[model samples]
Target: MASAPLNEVCLAALTLSIVFLTILWYKLTSNISHKEESRLPPGPRGLPIVGFLTFLRPNLHHQLTELSQHYGPIYKLWLGSKLCVVLNSPSLAKEVVRDQDSVFANRDPPIAGLVATYGGIDIGFSPYGSYWRDMRKLFVREMLSNRNLEASYSLRRHEVRKTIRNVHTKIGNLINIFELACVTKMNVVMSTMFDSNFVEKHRIDGAEFRELVVKFLQVMGKPNISDFFPMLARFDLQGIQKEMEAVLKSVDSILDPAINERMKMLSEGEIWGKGKKDFLQILLELMEQKDIEISVDLVKIKAILVDIMIGGTDTTITTIEWVMTELLNNPEIMGKVQRELKDVVGMNNIVEESHIPNLHYLDAVLKETLRLHPALPLLLPKRPSQSAVVGGYTIPKGTKVFLNVYAIHRDPQVWESPLEFQPERFLNSTNLDYAGNNMKYLPFGSGRRVCAGLPLAEKILMLILASLLHSYDWKLPEGENVDLSEEFGLVIKKSKSLFAIPTPRLPNFELYQ
Candidate 1:
């Protein structure tokens, strides 16, 4: 008696119900059979085949945080066929990163990242073993060492001062804050790495380089069909792999010339590392000094350079933008930062690198900003090399582990009014340090595979935020309000770029120039 469409709908519903019930039954039996050996972590029983894919939210971090409330601190989700474990508490995070660090040091680099990172040879997401250790040491010792960073301070200072002068030129005009931050950070990075400055270089447009970086970042963050389903990876169903490769081509074009020039300089014995050591010179010297125990090849050098360039720029740019957004949204907090800067550096003077440490309130503001909006909210997905037990449950080998530090930072048990923006919490905190010693507050991640550029990242971010606040008063354009909404991707960025008007507060025009 029913129409044909109605009959088809009824049949489909019945089929789906049977499939769902059958999957649940299978899981129950499988668990019972393996119960004596190992207990699997508890999680939602999703639909057959696709698993929990249908329930995925646009903001994956929030969804994972919400799931934590129901599944407890440690829970699993079947994301399109891949088994994912989400750790929502500091203790659980400590167990994985600290208590049993080596076991989980392996990385399952996403499909897009694999192409972007040139097949996972880079330090950050490389597999756990000798190669990763070698690269990390080379980066920390040769490039990012305190001595090297100190030597490069003048380069960094030059870039920041140049940015201030440019900002001074357009004193009350509406400008994109993220663009400004990107160019400044790019200038510093280029100057330090290749003895080049974006502001001074007219041949290469700053906007072009900025666009390439943003595009590459978006690709790295995009949810590729291949990452969720390994079987689909070879097909390149969504073209994400191809797209990432293209972005890499553009980036490599920029980096290739620098690498070649350094190579030629080293071969010609031109006294490359005699003074003002750039990262390229350090790597070249290591490569030439065959007596050195560590490994340094041209391939490794380029890989590390790409890693530094991508990692350094995005994190600082996003942090500056977010800190400014939060401060603008809360004028009282903005006033507090200005007062601290005034007391430390004086109202007539602009902030400098040395004055940064003296401004404790500014430190609190930076820490608070990091806590609220971590650049990598999920913090570079880590993988287990072998089966491991966590929180009394068996975690199967190769399960992608998402250490939800963002969730942990917002845990009501750990922070008071966790959702509210409060920098005072960090004003005198003894336990919390960005060094990853405190499991609850690892802005740069914790353990062996942590971010290699932490020292520079901290210095650059703090100085940028402090200098900007000390120099100007900012306001949104007419009818435009600050939007604190965030977009989750490879890096968490504001849904919109922060565009505001800047007014110079300095008494002297000489300082601006």
Candidate 2:
């Protein structure tokens, strides 16, 4: 009887093992079939688990371009288990940014953006719901309206003049144009946002606020492995979150006092009519309204400051630096732009908003520079809140959608000699404008969430470039040609900091003497 029982137990164990194996096989096959049936846009097959994570180089734009050539315009790649669909062609980009605008309006929940802006309460990372709409409306009405533009014009003009003066002082010496551009842009942004020229104050720490701004941007822009693979995200593999949190704390520490003082002034009604009604004042006034009960928190204030600093300063500086780099590389185009500025602005006076419309060639050079090197080349990653079809492929809900503005801008089919630095291409096209209507050149992006500071940014860029060219001639550093190589981040900065020697030019001088 004991031997018989033992044989029965052995048989039952074998049967159970077989059943487990069969179930596992069925599940594995079903998963494979479902994955296959999804029919995601074609891409290079990546390894299991990691999924193209290893193939991504530091220069994301080049990598994406190479992949686009192989996998057509619209392609899908797996960033770990998450599906990232990259839209490469202009037509496809238009469909996502325009035709299906609302569908892809949401932002991906990257840890960096979350930490930097306190969980997407800021305008940039905020979702496409009521909060986003209200914040955007406030941003446009308070920060970027025509009255604000007029009030801020003198500040911008003064900043540009100071930039020219600084560059002229460093004439004939190799200067870091990147730093110059960054400082100039920050000064302008600060003056507009805070009603104070903090850059002008000589602090012992040497522009502590500006340095903090740079640190914040660097930390926010740095790539985090956690953002890609959630499994590793739990480990904080790259320590990106820690770094972001530290930087956020530092930034908050710096801005808290200023915010509190401003709040006090607003409560006492002493801030409104005292200054020219800067961005912070406007936001405070709006917050006082019964309809808009904007919370008075360090996070909300810091978030707004982040928007102003990152959105206003970084893009402006990058655009100016790139335009100057291109001009230094191709002196002839630079000469043309200078000539236009001289003729339009008369060189004795500063370039005003009125002069911008007349300087067509200068506009073209700016447009082309933007085309060749968009400030935010990838143009802020967006995700789908719901399932949708793009280019006949089903993009499932919660899929990260990257509108590859860099790739689309460089598409050979859409642009003639896409790789070349040709500003004249824009001069001939009427369809190209920066108002988000033009799908071809989206330097400031398009759709409902297009950059709120577009008008202000354009004015600043035009005025700053015009003033610089109007006052000085730019040349590359000694023994080095202008480097066109690019570096990747939230913003696409030049690989090498743009180093140039500015030579003060005679008013209206067209040629370097």
Candidate 3:
């Protein structure tokens, strides 16, 4: 009788505890529901499981802009299992990029970017940490520093002049503007990274490097189904990841030998750049230095090198092509740019790098082209590190954020006639810069994650564009019209290749030599 009574008491206690726990759970869930109702950015209702995967468009930037109109500036979309936030307005973008820069500085690069960047070892995609900070510091202070650029001026000058001379030969022929720019830019990038003589020696062997860059970028920018569904990535469902690997293998074939040669040179105490080191020399020195703050291996060095090589080439070359295309499309703007060129850098002599700053109208034209055709229209996607509130909505952590600068740059509220190419709009706006400070115009993005190569890109772009406009007058190939329609990719490229004919405007052809 005594044992039976104890068992009954234990059972009654268990039932009471279960009831109490259930009441506690209900209260917690009700509070969570209330909190969720107030938070969570408004967006299109997505389907179960897949969310907005089915709604993705080929022209994502345009589609996102259109979506912003209906969903408001800050909106959310679920791509497969991923939560993506689109920041359309400058104010919204400012929150993610500026106010919460530390939280959102991390990038959510696609699989291809990861593979191309050696699994995020480079400064481009590396998390905001000691390694990234040190690498960036070294790159800015040593590699792409003003002093280093000045030291390498002759090489930049040589490559630009070489391109001019080559174009002079093909003056009457229809020149593929992007191809010309790509090759010329690549030449400069190679020389800047290594040695000019080193590039000259390896040009024949590295011919395929050009094609590899084109393919790598195509693969890097192409949308992959795997990125939306991480589970599908390993299967190579879209084949984008596989193709990127193949292109990288080819790129490695070129880079390995070149890097090995550089290593040998460093080991032999040749000091390729002497006292004024190139990127390769500086990187090699870092590897040899024992007291270096950042611990970087060969792989990290190579990844950083690739970032610089690809980043340096694509931004300048593609933007230069667009600048030419815009100038060609708008004859009035073209005349204005040429007149400014003539005034700042006379027809009596070829333009020098020093003349770049004085050509205000040309700068306006360049800026105008960028406004229309930002290299990355939706600047590289960023990922918030933790759950955060943005624009009065709770943006859950790890959500992919795309700041639609293209849309912001062309917003009707911001500009008088946003769609039309108007370089004059920027004529008096000396405060406006591409450095991401002005949210109204962030060609290079903003905040901590702003493009690491902005300084170099600015200098190279101004120099190259100024040189071309000053040295030559361009025409459409006999019976062709310029196509301003965009072909979106890693870089926003022209819908069709610009085939323009060039005629020398300089009094002395020898200046090109």
Candidate 4:
């Protein structure tokens, strides 16, 4: 009787344990399924805690491209605690960035922007508001207006000549044209912004400024742990804020001296009396005008300089480098462009700004290059100012949105054989510019915050590209193939440095002198 009672007690304990486990498993699975069905876009399920982070590779574009194949155009992925919705088609991108532009016009204040701009006070990161409107208007009217363009024309022409001379001197030697392009572009912007030039004998802090700008761009482009986790944002989890602050300090050190010098000149009536016209001079004039306070912190001044440095240098150079690389890799296309340049500008003359308009084939090549490798493969992240529905999904207010320009550009549905580098496609099409009206090409972005420097950048790039093509026939160094692989940061850069050998064309030989 005692043995039977003991066996019954053991049996009861085993049965209860099994029943409890079954209930717990059911509840956990049920909760997960419910969460999954709550209307999030299709995506690969990720592992616990770390999410899909481990799956991400160094070449983020490739990783995203592959994921889009399996997950459709609009897909979701978790980076740590944050949910990222990537728009993969041109139409979808237009929906988010164009059709609903106002709803998504606000910028997501990245850690770098916050620190660099002193908490989103700068034009680039300032949320969509009255202040941003005011600053943007100032940028447009004073800095990039036609008057400013005319003022800077002489400096641009001089820089173009300097670049040609540099290339002419390097005729038989292997040269990294990308580096040359960067230096030349920087000099042009510097000359216009400050009355200084990057002469061989007069090194006016160009190296220091270049170093600081590069550092700032790299740090700002890094993936921040704080960005993905809202809880850790305030803590600056990955030390991004610290890194940014250090860069900002370096930038301010260089900028403040220039600003102070200009201020002193203004107080002394040196600028007004001389009747000089420079970017700084123009801005000072605006600052003094009635109805404009010009904020004591000099936010407008710093912001304009930052915009020039950020907007002016890397992007234009990168575009030129990519175009040159593509042309070199595909000689047929290059030959066509060269022929066009020769026909339009003629071999006897240098390609001046006046010549750019007539170089249709060269313009097409530039558009094609931008289509393939937009500087910001994913343009700056935009945040929703208010809750809205996009493609049937509710986007909560403050949700970060990104238009994947890379994916959109590469989509086969939009362009036949999208991977091919055929500039002819652009020649055949009526729509070829970066204005928001055209969804197919948005290298300069679109809508309210479209790049302020678009006109200047386009003019400079076209002139430089046409001039180089008109002046020289270029070849890749050695037997190496020109690599089209890309790396992304604040801007996308070639994975390998593009080195080439340039031989001056006989027709444009006189221009080199």
How much lDDT does each candidate structure score?
0.82, 0.77, 0.81, 0.77
Model 2: ten consecutive residues of lowest lDDT: 197-206
Clashes in model 3: which pairs?
A: none
Whole-structure CA lDDT of model 4:
0.77
Model 3 regions lying over 4 Å from their true place = 1-38, 202-204, 271-276
Which candidate number would show the highest lDDT if scored against the true structure? 1
RMSD of 3: 10.0
Error of 3 at 463 (Å): 1.9
Model 1 CA lDDT for position 154: 75
Report the Cα lDDT for candidate 3: 0.81
Give lDDT tens digits, candidate 2, residues 362-479. 9999989888898877778888877777888877777788878888788877888999998888888897988667777787789987887788888988888887788787777668
lDDT of 3 by residue, 59-161 (tens): 7778888999999998888776677888888888888888888999899989999999988889899888778899888877777777887888777787888
As for candidate 1, its clashing pairs are: 221-490
- Clash number by candidate, in order: 1, 0, 0, 1
Candidate that beats the other on TM-score, 2 or 3, i.e. the better one? 3
Candidate closer to the true structure by TM-score (higher is better), 1 or 4 = 1
Q: Distance from true position, residue 215, model 3, in Å?
A: 1.7
Off by over 4 Å in 1: 1-38, 197-205, 269-274, 478-480
Q: Model 4, clash count?
A: 1
